[model samples]
Target: MIIYDLACTAGHRFEACLGSMFDPNPDCGCGASTSRVPSRLNLGGAANAGPGRDDMPTTWHGTGQGDPATLKAWHGAMTKRERLEERYPELAGDRRPILAHEGAFAGRPLRAGDDLVPTVAKAAFGKEES
Candidate 1:
């Protein structure tokens, strides 16, 4: 199935799913026939490449290798967030800290939904437990 925007003779616009590309127009809510409308292909804005009002491709091609000096200068010109994302694309939308190893718990202890091993609270200068 393919989704397409359609407009009725009565000026109603809506989205519809057609079984085939050549399928007949579907009826609108007001019982008027709807015709397929040309939709815009909107690929969202790209990230800024430098301090100026410049745009950069959202994706890279090939091995993404470049001359050390040139790449260092380009990287230095990017914002902190851009630099972080360029270095770790996999963590683009994640807000948590990246850990080198697995965590002790799968999630926050309060929301782990498992019995937690309680730790004993001790005084700062208290004797060590035998």
Candidate 2:
């Protein structure tokens, strides 16, 4: 999928995710034909930096790892609540809440309901162990 920034003849500006670049122009909803306008995408640390666009990122490294909330923002996901619901569908809308850090499960394998704290993990498991 691709997001196209479109501007209508009636002066409406909007974006839509379309299947292909060659796909027919989508209606601009203002009874006018929309034209694909230029936009910048900053994904995986690469972006189109050209004369028309500002906000050129000077420094961006590979993937980042830190607090779960920051990671969620980097993942471009919604709030912690929504991500947890998506990852654990049965727990959706639970009156009880799970914080993002807790959801990380501290490097444990996913969906197994088993985890270990750092100190305990170092003591009980070895590097070669799965």
Candidate 3:
């Protein structure tokens, strides 16, 4: 989506998001016609290619290369487990401990119902696991 700063005939200014810059101006609340104007978003920034942002994509966790939701869920589960263990030292649980190398998806331990990343599962337990 593209956002543009627009000005109406009545001198009112507002921003609108459009699928393309060539789209017609949107109606203003003042019942006046509007025209697209220059904005900072169209300037040189995140949307444009640059020396640092042009680097090749990577494929690892902790390096901006993996699925963010999976990574977040994994860490959330790990943090919850840690808090539980801290609150209840004598709580009865499996001795395996939450280990990432066992059945983790991204970089954290897998919970009771979490599934591993497809490639990671296949790599850890062959194609059948995937």
Candidate 4:
């Protein structure tokens, strides 16, 4: 199955998996008929090509790992977070991890009820971790 970007007359956009020979037209969540929309080619890296727009990038090679010259220039001039915000303006002031960097778990192994939400919540509210 191939996934294609689709949009309805009402301006809703979504994706659907279809057979190669199957009709491209599909119904949108708003119940409006949809048509195929232009999508970017994803070479695969992180973040699933991001909304499939021409202006948006399909891959992100992290903040300090893209071009050698860019990295060299940013070395003493910008922090990783600063560079990230510069590259992706939408993420400005966002305090979430750009990518998964799961550090080594301490103490006992996590049980079924364990999760990382509290850790995030604590940081968000300025509460120190227990």
Candidate of highest TM-score: 1
Runs off by more than 4 Å, candidate 1: 43-130
Model 2: how far residue 83 lies from native, Å: 21
Candidate 1 residue-wise lDDT, 11-96, digit = tens: 99999999999999899999999899999876897765334213322334321455566556545655554766678686354444
Candidate 3 residues 64-112, lDDT tens each? 5677776676566556656666676554255444335453345544544
- Model 1 TM-score relative to the real fold: 0.34
Better of 2 and 3 by lDDT: 3
**Clash statistics: count for each candidate:** 0, 0, 0, 0
Worst 10 residues of 3 by lDDT: 48-57
lDDT of 4 by residue, 21-128 (tens): 476577898899888988987777675322212222234464334777755654534455456667888755344433333332232323344456665544455464
Task: Name the weakest run of 10 consecutive residues (lDDT summed) in model 4.
Answer: 49-58
> What TM-score does prediction 3 earn?
0.31
CA lDDT of every candidate: 0.59, 0.57, 0.63, 0.59
Over all chains combined, what TM-score does candidate 4 have? 0.30
Write the residue-wise lDDT of candidate 2 on 16-75 in tens digits: 999998898899887899899889766677542222112212234322335555555544
Return the TM-score for each candidate structure: 0.34, 0.32, 0.31, 0.30
User: How many residue pairs in model 4 have overlapping backbones?
Assistant: 0
